[model samples]
Target: MRPTVHDIAAAAGVSLATVDRVLNQRPGVRRITREKVETAIREIGYVRDVAAANLAKGRTYPLVFILPASDNSFMHGLHAEIREAMIRSPSERTSIRTVEVAAFDPAALVTALEKLADERPAGIALVATDAPEVVAAVDRLVADGIPVVTLVSDLTGSRRHHYAGVDNIAAGRTAARLLGRFLGDAKGEVAVLAGSMLVRDHRERLEGFAALMAQEFPKLSILPVLEGRDDPELAHMLVADVLSKHERVIGVYSLGAGNRGLVRALKARASSRPLTVVAHELTVHTRAALIDGTIDAILNQNAGHEVRSAIRVLKAKADGLAVIDAQERIRLDIFLKDNLP
Candidate 1:
């Protein structure tokens, strides 16, 4: 049986109130009494159940989710999942809120983080813009004893307590393998679409995808990445221009959001030529694109699962408890035209 405060009190020959004060670091306990309680705790090995105690006391964790205010299907879906979590906040003993910043703007993200550092919520989850300043801000929050989790897009070098996102580099490498195999020894220029190089996830995906392509599929040359800024209209314009200019392009890798733009562009320039397409995120746009033969494959990570994992990890970190690493790992999901789900 696990030792409790009662056991510690009994071992220390002290009252329950004195043990509670020592455990919670509350005042009014003398130095010697605190030392005796500490000695008893060390001897009995009493482990406090933070969650259970918080529940017993009706403690509410105030958590904030920081997201980019982008007009894309995936971002919309992620926001929706956060809202659903908020709906269940009362039962979960949490107070959840969201803060939207400009997409791909490091200064705005830094400002938001600075403001949050002042408020000092119980925990924070953010879709990080991977800039140096943003990393510094996250480090400051961690130094201030605030537990932070990166959601969807992670800042790897920062002192974030956890990442509630998929292995993006692996996802990119998988996309390359799938795209290369789908094309099957065909030699042509491949067009890649991305949101921005500012975010760590996009940069890592592009890096992994490019590395694998160069190593395994040397025949298919990748064109310069088109930064569509995750804007549907911008993506549409960029893709259409590329298709019109690069006649040798035979494969497309939509490695970021704004697939609707890519889809519209591809459909407008549909031809008999074998142009294989692989994308990220299983959204309404990508689903329809896959069904209509515009997208051949999709690599997805569950937004709902990511949100829940972030919450769990943040809560555990705030309580100074170790989380089960396996339980928090976000798995990648692959969807093809034949296995649409």
Candidate 2:
């Protein structure tokens, strides 16, 4: 049988109220008394029943998730996942709300974070742009005791408690391996399209791709990175420009969202030259492109898994409970035309 508060109080020679105060970090307990209670708790291995505690406190963690307002299909998918989570939230004893802001706008994101912080929700989940002001805002929220988790993209130097996303470096390595092996000893220039260098995920993906190309596929040369800002129209224009300039380009890797533009660009240029394309995210456009031989492979991160992981971690942190590491792990999902889910 597990020991109760009464047993801990008796063992520490303290009143029940004193033990309660100490355990909950409430006021009115002396340091010595608190230490004695803690010692007793340690000796007895007393673990607080989080469910019971929350129930007693009538706590239902209100979580706020801030997502990018980009028209990219991937962001749309993430929004859908969050909506699904909201539908299932009641069963999990929590409530969730979302705020959408323009992508790649650090000032706008910071302003949104500030507003959310003012509301003082139990937790916050956001896709962070690698900006100093954004990081400072997240730090301020952490300092105020709000649990913040970075989703999709991370703020590495910030006080965000956890990042609920894939190791984009590994994802890039996987993409390179797939592209290199599929192309087999074929050598030609490879064009790289990225969302923006300001995003940590995009930067990491570029780094991994560069490392793999330099070490393993020295035969293939990487062209200057094209910034699409995860915009379909921008991606299309950039891809068209690259294709026009480099007729010898054999492959393309899009390490960002907005593959619709990529597909359009590839289809337009397919008649003149067949370029093997590898992109991130398995959206409808990319999936159809893969089926029609426009795209060779896709490196995807499950948005549903990311959203669920963030919610779980935020809830645990808000309740001061340790998170289950394995359960919170985000995995890279590989997709080929043959198998896509």
* lDDT of the candidates, in the order given: 0.93, 0.91
**Model 2 C-alpha lDDT per residue in residues 205-232, reported as the tens digit of each score:** 9899989988999889999999999999
What is residue 248's positional error in candidate 2, in angstroms?
Answer: 1.0
Q: Could you tell me which 10 consecutive residues in candidate 1 have the lowest summed lDDT?
A: 266-275
What TM-score does candidate 1 reach?
0.97
Q: TM-scores of all models? A: 0.97, 0.91
Task: Give candidate 1 regions above 4 Å deviation.
Answer: none
Off by over 4 Å in 2: 9-43
Which ten contiguous residues of candidate 2 have the minimum total lDDT? Answer: 50-59
CA RMSD per model (angstroms) = 1.2, 2.6
| Steric overlap count per candidate | 0, 0
Q: Per-residue lDDT tens digits of candidate 1, residues 235-302?
A: 99999999999999999999899898999999989874668999999998899889988889999999
**lDDT (Cα, 0-100) at 18 in candidate 2:** 97
